[model samples]
Target: MTIQRLEVSNPEFTPNNTQMVTVHSSHLKRRHDINFYNVNASGQNLPVIILLHGVYGNSWVWMNLGGIDKAYEKVKAELNIPEFILAMPSDGGRLDGSAYLPSLNAGNYEKWIVEDVIDACKQTLDSVTHNSHFYISGLSMGGYGALRLGAKYPNLFNGISAHSAITKLADMAHFVETPLSEYQCEHSSEADVMYWLKKNHHQLPKIRFDCGQDDVLYESNLQFEKQLKDAQIPYLFEQFSGGHEWAYWHLHVQKTVKFFADIEQSL
Candidate 1:
C-alpha cells in the first residue's frame, strides 16, 4: 500500500497525543501507516517504546483496546515512568501476521519491525532517535516478536516484555505455509526463542514475559520459561487469570509499560 499524507477524521478516538503516519518499508515493498504517540514531545531525555500487535490485528488494536490513553495518562500522572514515545505499526503481512520474521519466501518482515519501524519513528518524531533508550512489548504474536527482537538486538532495547507470547517456532505452523525449521533459518540467527536466546546470551536484554492461565498458549509459555530457567537466564514471568483476548492484554499492558519504566530506572 502506498502511504500518503492525509487528515485523520475518525471519530473513534479522542486524540490526546496520538497521530497516524506512514513510513515506507523497503523490506515489505510498501508504505504503511503507524499509530504513533509522543508523550511530551518537547520534553527532553525521553525514551521510546514500540508496541507490536498480534495476528488478525493492526496497530489500531492498541488504541481500540484503550491501552494508549491509559499508558499516557498513567505513565505520566501515576506511574514513575519517564517520558516516552509509543509507536504501533501494522506489520504489512497478508493473512494473519509476519511473525516478525524475514524469509526469501515469506518477504522481509523482520526488517519491517527492526529497521523500517525504527527509521520511521526517528524521522517522524523529533524526540526519538538511534540513541534514545528503547523498549518493546506486544500481545500474543507481537509478544513473540518483542522477545525475539530483544534477544536479537539487545543493544537496541533496554528491556522487552511479552504477554501470552508464542515461545516456540513450530507453534506458528498453522498460519504460514513454510516449514518451521526453514522459516526460522531464513535471514536470521535462530527462530526458536529459547535457541536464539541461548545462542545470543551475551546480547540478551532485560527480559520478562507472562501468559494468561486459561490461554491456549499457556503450556507453550511454561515450556519456554522452563527453558530459560534451565539455562539460567534471569527473567520475570507471571500468570494472571484471563484468556487470550483483549481484556487480558489491555490490563497487562500497563504492567509492561511499568516494567520498562523499572528498567529505565536501573539504567
Candidate 2:
C-alpha cells in the first residue's frame, strides 16, 4: 500500500482551495487522480470525506463541476462544523466506468479505492492521519461505490452518503457501455450491495442516500430502500425534485457535508 510517486499541482491552476494529486498506485499499477481540498493545513487529526465520481468522470468533477469545495466551506462556516479534508478520486479510469468493483477481467478497482486512494490521502495530507474519521460519498455510479464500499468496509468509514446512486451492479448497464460480463467475479456477493449490507448489518455506520424524483435510477433506489428495510437495516432516504444531472448533485452535496458533520458531532 505504497504510493510509488506523487505529483501535486499548484492551487493557482485548480479550483477554489483544491489541489489535484496524482499517485502512482501499486494496486492499479498506474497513476490515479485525486482532487484534494484542505483549507487548514495546520489543523491536526481532521476528518476526511472521500468523494467518488461517476462514469466518464475523474476526480475534478466534484470541485470543478459541482463546486464541492465551496459547498464544504459554506457548510463548515454555517454549521460550525470542524474542518474536513475533501479527497475526490477517479474510478480507476476504466472504459466509461469501472463501477468501482473488483473484476476478473479488470484489475482490483475496489482495492484501488479502499486501499490505494486512502493511502495516498494519508501520505499527502498532513491533516488526514490514521486516526481521522473517514466519510464516503458520491453521485450516480460513484454512489454505488460509496455505499457498497462503505458497507463492505465498515471499519474504514464513519459515515456514508450517496446521491442518485446506482443501487445495484445491474444498474451500471444504464451508464456504462462496457459489457456486464466483464464485471464478473468469483464470489457473487462481491457484486451485490445487499449482500454486503446484510453481512455487516450490525457493524455498519450511519447510512444515508437520496435520489431525484425524475432521475433514471429513482425506481431502483426505491427498490434498494425496500431491500434495506427488509433486511432490518436502518438508513435515511430522501427524494428531491430534479434529474440525474450535475445541477442536482451540486445543490444537494451540502446535505452530505452536513450529514457527515452531524455524524462527527455524535462521535
Candidate 3:
C-alpha cells in the first residue's frame, strides 16, 4: 500500500491546562482515522511516549480518568520524574481494538502505530522533531500493543509499560470476535509478540507490567511474567488491590512515567 502523505489536525486544547488533542488522517492503511491527546512537558525534543488505549476507548481516556496534569504533578512532586510529552492515541480499528497489529481484515494497523502515528506527531507538535525520544505504554489491549511493538522494534523505544494488559492471544476470546487462529494468519500479523520476542528479546527495552489482584487477567500476567523470567528477562512486576478498570490504570500510570523517566535519563 502506498503510504500517502499524513494529515494531522491542529491541536485542540481541553478544559484541563495540561493537555491538547490532535486527530490525524492516516494514509498507511484503510483505517485512516487516528487521534491522540498530548500532555506537553514544555521543552524541545521531549520523550514522545505514545499511549495506546484499550477497546472501546479513545484518545481522551487518560485525560478524562486520571488527568495527565494531575499525574505529572504527583510524579514530579513526589518522584522528581523528568518532564515528557504524553501521546495517547485511539487504536481505531475493530470494536475489540485492533490489538495494534495488522490484521487480515484491518490493513496494516501495526504500521499505523509503529510508523504513521509517530509521523503524525512529528508534524503536529513543533517541540517534537525527528530525533525526539520515544516510549510506549497502555492499559489492557493497549498494554498488549505496547509490549508487542516494543518487543518487535526494540530500537525505537527506550522503555515499555502496561497495566492489567492482555498478554496472550487466547485471552482475547472473551472480548473479541476474531479467533486466535485467524489472528495468527501471516497476512494479519506483522509482529505478533509470539514470534517477535525470539528475535528481539536481547534488545527489548526496559520492561514493566502489572495487573490488579481482583482482575481476570492477573493469572495470565503471572504466566507472562514467568515467560520473561524463564527467558532470563528482567522486569518490574507488581500486583495491587484492584481490578481491570480505569481506577487501577490511573493509580499506576504514574509509575509507568517514572519508569520511563529513569530509562530516558540513564541513557
RMSD of each: 3.6, 1.5, 2.8
Cα lDDT of model 3 by residue, 112-177, tens digit? 778777776677677788888899998888889998988888988889998988987677775777
Q: Per-residue CA lDDT of candidate 1, range 10-81, in tens?
A: 425637677776665667766666787764368654688899888778878888875666756665688666
lDDT of 2: 0.88
* True-vs-predicted CA distance for residue 204, candidate 1, Å: 1.5
Per lDDT, what order, best first?
A: 2, 1, 3
Q: Model 3 clash pairs?
A: none
lDDT of 2 by residue, 165-258 (tens): 9998889999877888888887878989989999999999999999999999999999999999999999999999999999999889999999
Give the TM-score of each candidate. Answer: 0.88, 0.96, 0.87
TM-score, cand. 1 vs. native: 0.88
Q: All models: lDDT?
A: 0.77, 0.88, 0.74
Clashes found in each candidate (C-alpha, N, C closer than 3 A): 0, 0, 0
- Scanning candidate 2 in windows of ten residues, the lowest lDDT window is 10-19
